[model samples]
Target: MTEGLLTAKAVMERLSQSGQRVVTAESCTGGLVSALLVHHAGASDCVEGAFVTYSNQLKHSALDVRDETLARFGAVSAETVTEMAEGALRAAARATVAVSVSGIAGPGGGSDEKPVGLVWFGLAVNGKKTKAVSQNFEGSRTEIRWQAALYALQLIAGYDE
Candidate 1:
């Protein structure tokens, strides 16, 4: 396990103590979040599964992000990720919490409105209102992805506001 995986392990242990399970959805970060969670022992106590929705189609088909929402807000928007989190909560039958990430990590494909390294995160705890946040990191593609993955784990650990 790497540094982020270590953080994920701590978060998983806490979640296990709380008797809470988490479902993860990833876009630009791929399965990094899921992989980290499962790397440590006792993962089954806190991890349900993960969805790697690298495309809009899979985000819709797997995580239930509506086409209209995607068309209106785009994949990296707070609105889209909020829906993704909510959908993931429903998809993971045993999970009571969900986290979703969408972003652009690239040397290209960035506009002034949504630049590269801009990521949106959505977190939902069952029977609670879902929350979304957008942040921008400065780095290469790999660094940006690492930051996003670590941030997602922080969110799961309740370390982020």
Candidate 2:
């Protein structure tokens, strides 16, 4: 939380200053990214909207994540998150940038391929190119979600660079 304060504030301040708005699509982080952005003052100037698609149905319905993508790659894949970010951008229309997160954060559901704390992030900015990154953190469910949120904020802050 402390680590993300400066980054989240800087992200909102920079986005607001540049007159760019941000939208978020979330899964395992469950709107934690949006919560972090909205925590700071003046965030309304930059934040456009956010969706907490914790279920695959909502991921497909709300963020337009493709059914085939979800079937092939599952909910926690880069493909799913990329689609989630792009879907958010297209749906919101007003936002110039968007970020999406999906992962497995739990004391259970840790597979050999996609273990717990394994998170995939997608960033779409200026409609140039979308970027996706996969990260694995070690902690309780709460800590993993917090780390994922912090990383999402960092991604948004770096999108301009």
Candidate 3:
């Protein structure tokens, strides 16, 4: 299996042991993060569910990402990503941890402010503790998405707060 998949499995194992569950809210990477999390055996034990909100409209409607957030900071901003994570946590009250992703993964749709491969990641844990990270990956669309998913999994594996 790929390193990314392996990392996801390891994360799932840890969360299961801790009696915690995880949920995913995804955007630019589509459902890649959720897919990787469930690719391993026994994932059902720790994975709650996934929300694939690929559009700004979907982000607003499905995840309750504030329209003002998207309008002011755009979909890939820290604000929008954090809202996505919060939305996931709210939607899955049983999940102790949640991760959200949004980005511009493309050979197009990039501007000076938000380039292709520019991604934002958000994590939300119980007590509503949260963090947001930004990454600029270098590659084709598929490579960018794969790397984004892998990075998110790695964060979960090392999370302490």
Worst 10 residues of 1 by lDDT: 152-161
* Candidate 2 lDDT over residue span 87-114, tens digit each: 9999998899999999989989989999
Report the C-alpha displacement of residue 29, candidate 2, in angstroms.
0.9
**Native-to-model Cα distance after best TM-score fit, residue 3 in candidate 1, in Å:** 2.6
In model 3, what lDDT does residue 34 have? 83
Question: What Cα-based lDDT does every candidate model obtain?
Answer: 0.91, 0.91, 0.90
lDDT by residue (22-52, candidate 3, tens digit) is 9999998788888888998899899999999
State, as a TM-score between 0 and 1, how close model 1 is to the true structure: 0.96
CA lDDT of 92 in candidate 1? 95
lDDT for position 4 in model 3:
82
Taking all chains together, the TM-score of candidate 3 against the true structure is: 0.96
Estimated TM-score for each candidate: 0.96, 0.96, 0.96
| Candidate 2 CA-lDDT value | 0.91
**Relative to the unseen true structure, what is the Cα RMSD of model 3?**
1.1
